[model samples]
Structure formats: structure tokens, C-alpha cells
Target: MVTYNTMIHGFCKKGDLYTARRVLDRMKDSKDCLPSTVTYTTLIDGYCKKGELEEAMKCMSEMNKQGCLPGLFTYNALIRGSFNKGDIKNAQKVFDEMTCKRDIITYNTMIHGFCNNGDNYAQKVFDEMTCKRDIITYNTMIHGFCKNGDNYAQKVFDEMTCNRNMITYNTMIHGLVKKGDLDTARRFGLNEG
Candidate 1:
């Protein structure tokens, strides 16, 4: 069963959905083993990454019908695919439909999506997250703000209590430079010394 799952994952990662589906079909034929949630997730993620959202959604529905509970990782992939296509409505729909507790990755995907869409939704998600946020969370906001040329990235930097790393510093510097805030960038760059 594990081997079957691995084969599915390999085909999916290779973006050969047909072969992946064939492997899944073979799995379904065997009475000795049942496909797991991880199997469906790999297929959904592959389809989403390939921009085949319809197929992904179908797999998601099938996954649920097969008694496989789609978890945060699967939900995140769907949200990301929606965001990749600038479809916030669908993204939010999937987000709202999440039956499991969301983690930082889920919120980060939302923030990154909203940021890419030029909305302030990230702030709301950032505030509402009940889980412990890591540097990736902070970096997402900072990078988003910097990409949008907004000085608000600095405020997010200020909010980080600890775990600041080179990525954080580089994002801030790059953002400041992108926004033409060279003087402020200089001040920040000096801090890195």
C-alpha cells in the first residue's frame, strides 16, 4: 500500500496526472488496500500546481466521499491554487470550509494571497491566528508589504518578538530598497553590521 502511494506521489510530482490517476485506479481495484488521505492530497496538490483546479476539486470531493478527511495541508494547496489564479472568493470559501484547526501555513497562505491581491486581509488573519506564528509568518507580511512598496512592512518587523533571521533582515532591506527608501534602508543595513 505504501508502495502504491509512493508511485502515485511520484507520478503526481512529475505532473503526469494521467499516470497518477491510473495508479489510483489500480489502487481502487484492490480489495486488500484502501487509499489514504495522503494519497489524495498528493494528487490534489499536483493538480492544483498544474492549474487544473477542476480536477483537484473533483479529487477533493472524492477524497471526502472515500472517508478521507482533507486536512490543513490539502486545504492550503487549494487555497494556494485559488490565490495563484487571483480567485480570492474560492480561496476564502475553501478557507471557511476547513473542518480542521488551521495552522500557521493556512493563515500564511491567506495573508500571501491577500497581499498579492492588494488587500489588507493579511492583517486580519494575522490578528486572529490563535497559533504560534514563526518567522515565515512575519516574513510573508514583510515581503508582501515590501513588494507593494508599503512602509507598513516595518511595523510587522517591529511586531516580531524573537526568531528574527537573515531572511527577515534581507526582506526588510530589499523591501526598503524597492520602495526607494534608501536612507531608511541605509539605517537598516547598518544594523546588520
Candidate 2:
């Protein structure tokens, strides 16, 4: 199973999805070793990265048909793939259909996707997060708000009392500069320095 997975990973890494699928088919034929969650995830991620969302969805369906429950990573890959393809509807559908408990990565992915697409739902996802958010979560929101040319970035920045990494400061400063608030940007840079 390890060997087969490695071969699949190699093929997928090389963008040889055709060979990757063939390897997966061969692995499925083996009685002792079946495709695991990792195997399907690798293939799905590869397809997603290649912008081959249809193939990724097909692989997801095959994984479900094989009785292998999709894990968090699997769902994340699908959501990201859908979003990357600018298929927000499908991305939301995948997110809504997720059965497993969502982790930070899932929420973060959605937030990033929504923000990148200039969608206002980034805040909705941020507000819906019940789990503890890390720096990435806050950073994503701040950056999104700034990108959208809203004052929400300042609101979010003011809310963060700690865990403010360089990214947080830089993003805030950049946003301020972009908004023609050079004074605020200079103050932030000085404080960071």
C-alpha cells in the first residue's frame, strides 16, 4: 500500500494524472491493499492544483462509492478546487455538505476564497467559526477587509490584542497606505520596527 501510494503521489506530482488514475485502478485491484483516504486526497489535490476540478469531483465520487469516508483534507481540497475554479456555488455546496466537523483549515479556506473573490461572505464564515482561530484566521480577515477597501480591517486589527505577527502589521500598514492613510501606515511601521 505504501509503495502504491508513493507511486501515485509521484505520478500526481508529475501532473501525470492519467498514470495516477491507472495506478489507483491497479491499487484497487489488489485485494490486500485498497485506496485509502490519503490516496484519494493526493489524487484530488493533484487534480485541483491542475485545475481539473471535474476529475477531482469524479475521484471524490469514486472515493465515496468505495465506502471511504471523505476526511477533512478531502473536503478542503474540494472546496479549494471549487473556489479556485471560480465556482463559488459548488464550493458552497461542498462546504455545506461536509459531514465531518470542520477545522480551522476549512474555515480559513472558505474565508480566503471569499476574500479573494471579493465576496462579502468572508465575514459570515469568520463569524460562524466556533473553534479557536489562529493568526491566519485574523490575518485573512484583515487582509480581505483591506482588499475590499473597508474599515473592517481596522476593526479586526483593533480586536487583536496579541498574536500579532509581522504579517498582521504588514497587512495593516499596507492597507492603510492603499487607503491613502500614510500617517497610520507610518505609525504602524514605526511600531513594528
Candidate 3:
């Protein structure tokens, strides 16, 4: 069964949805081997990566129908898929559901999902996350703001100065240079001195 899982994962990684489904179907046919949550997750993740939200959502629903309780990771994958599809309402729904069974990974995934989707209200998610925001959270938000070309991204960079990590500094410096604000970058560099 583990071999089947690996095969499913390999197919998923290669984005061979057809072959992945075939493997999944074969697993279902075996009385001794039922597809586990991990197997389903790998398939859903592949669908999400391919921007096939409909397929992913259908798989999630089927997982539920098969009496498989999704773990936080499964929910996170769905939330990410919804976010990637720009379906903020569905993403928020999954996020709210995850809050009832809070986990650090779940929070981080939702935050990164919103940040990656470039949703303005991603800041609300950042503010409301109960877990400690790791460096990745800050970097994700910074990248999102930079991609959005928001002037207030400077304010975010200013706020990040309190943290003063290398990646934070690098992001701000790059952002400033991109905006042709070498003076501000030089001032920040001096401040770090």
C-alpha cells in the first residue's frame, strides 16, 4: 500500500492527473488497500498546483463521502486551492473551519494563501492569526505587497524594521531600489549600521 502511495505521489508530482486517478482507482479496487488521507491529499495538492480547483474540490467532497475525515493538511490544501482560484469566500470558509481545530501549520497555510492571492484583507488574516507569525509569513506579505505595487508596502517595510531580519532588510532594500528610492535604502542601511 505504501508503494501505491508513492506511485500516486509520483504521478501527482508529475501533474499526470490521469495516471494519478488510475492509481487511485486501482487502490480503491483492492480490498487490502484503501487510499489513505495522504494519498488523497497528494492528488488534491496536484490538482491545486495545476489550478484545477473544480477537480480538487470534487476530490475533497468525495473524500468526505467516503467517510474519511480530512486532517488540517487536507483542509489547508483546499483553502490554498480556493485562494489560488481567487475564490476568497470559499477560502475564508475553510479558514474559519480550521480555526475551530487550530494548528500552527493551518494558520500559516491560510496566511500564505491569502498573501499569495494578493487579497487586500490578507492583513486581517495576519492580524487575527493566533500562532506566532514566522519569517515566512512576513516574507509572503512583503512579496504580495510588492507584487501589488502598493505604496503602503513601504509602511509594512517600516513596521518590519522592528524585526530587522536579513530577509526583511533585503526585501525592503530591493523594493526601494525597484521604486528608485535609493536614498531611503541608504538611510535604512545606515540605520542597520
Candidate 4:
């Protein structure tokens, strides 16, 4: 059962949600095995990655009904599923329900979701997170700003003076170039390290 769960996880990680589902079905058919939380988690993750939020929620419900305890990963997957579907309300509900224990990756996933939407609300999420923000978090918002021509994104770049990564420099240069600010782009390109 453990190996089966791991196989499903591997398939999901490789973005082969279809194969993951097939493995899950095989697990379900096996009389000798009982699906664990790991099994449900793998299936939920696979569904989330494939943007099948309804199916992912079903997996969550079934996991509970089967008396399998959900861990952080299960909740994380559901949160991401909701976020991916642009259901921020549901995502917030899931987030609010999580106990005090938190992971940085959960916040990062939410940041990415909001950024991908090109909505200004992403910045609010960033502002509210007390967890240490990493390069990916900054980059996601920066890219979103550049994509949407939101000046607020530029303000974030100005605010990030501590961890100036190469991607950060490159994104700024790309943003400037997009706006026909060749001089600024050249200056930013020189800052790339």
C-alpha cells in the first residue's frame, strides 16, 4: 500500500495525473489493501495539479469518511485547488481552518495563484503574510506587475533591497524594455548577477 501510494505521488509529481488516477483505481480495486491518507493526498494533489478542484474536494471528503486523518499536505492541496480555480473565498476558508502550524510553501502557492490572476489583490496577500518572503514570492508579484503594467509591482522591486537575485534583475530589465525604457533596462541589465 505504501509503494502504491508512492507510485501515485511520483506520477503526480511528473504531471501525469492520468497515470496517477489509474494507480489510484488499482489501489481501490485491491481487496488486500486499504487506502491511506497518503493515497488520498496523492490523488488530491494530482487532481489539483490538473485543475480538477471538484474531484480534489471529493477526494478530501472521501478521505474524511474513510477515517483517514488529513495532514498539512492534504489541506495544502485543497487550498491550491481552490486558488487555481480562482475561488479565493474557498481558499481563504481552507487557509483559515488550518491550525497555527504553517508552512512557507502554502503562502508561496497562494502568492503564485494571485499573481497568475494578474489581480492587484495579490499584493494584499503578500502584505498580510508575516512569513518570510523568498525570491519566488517577489518574482511572482513582479512578473505579474510587469505583465499587467501595475506600478505597484515596481514599488515591490524597490522595497526588496536585501535579496537581489539574478531573476529579479532580469525581470526588472525585461519590464523596463517592455515599456521602451531602454536606458533603465540597460542599467538594470548591468545589475544582473
Error of 4 at 94 (Å): 3.0
Residue 18, model 4: Cα distance from true site in angstroms = 8.4
Model 1 whole-model lDDT (C-alpha atoms): 0.87
Q: Of the candidates numbered 3 and 4, which has the greater lDDT value? A: 4
**Backbone clashes, candidate 3:** 0
Q: What CA RMSD would candidate 4 show?
A: 3.6
lDDT of 2 by residue, 1-193 (tens): 8898899989989999999999999888976799999999999999998999999999999999999999999999999999999999889999999999999899999999999999999899999997888899999999999888899998888787457899999999989999999998999999842
RMSD of each: 2.2, 1.9, 3.2, 3.6
Return the number of clashes found in candidate 2: 0
Off by over 4 Å in 4: 7-34, 83-89
- lDDT per residue for candidate 1 within 1-193, as digits (tens), equals 8898899889988889999988887888886787889889989998999998888899999999999999888999999998987789989999999999998789889988998888888889888998888888899888888888887888889889667888888888898888887887888887741
Backbone clashes counted, model 1: 0
Ranking of predictions according to lDDT: 2, 1, 4, 3
Looking at candidate 4, the ten consecutive residues that score lowest on lDDT are: 96-105
Q: How far does residue 19 in candidate 2 sit from its true spot (Å)? A: 0.6
Q: Over the full model, what C-alpha lDDT does candidate 3 score relative to the true structure?
A: 0.77
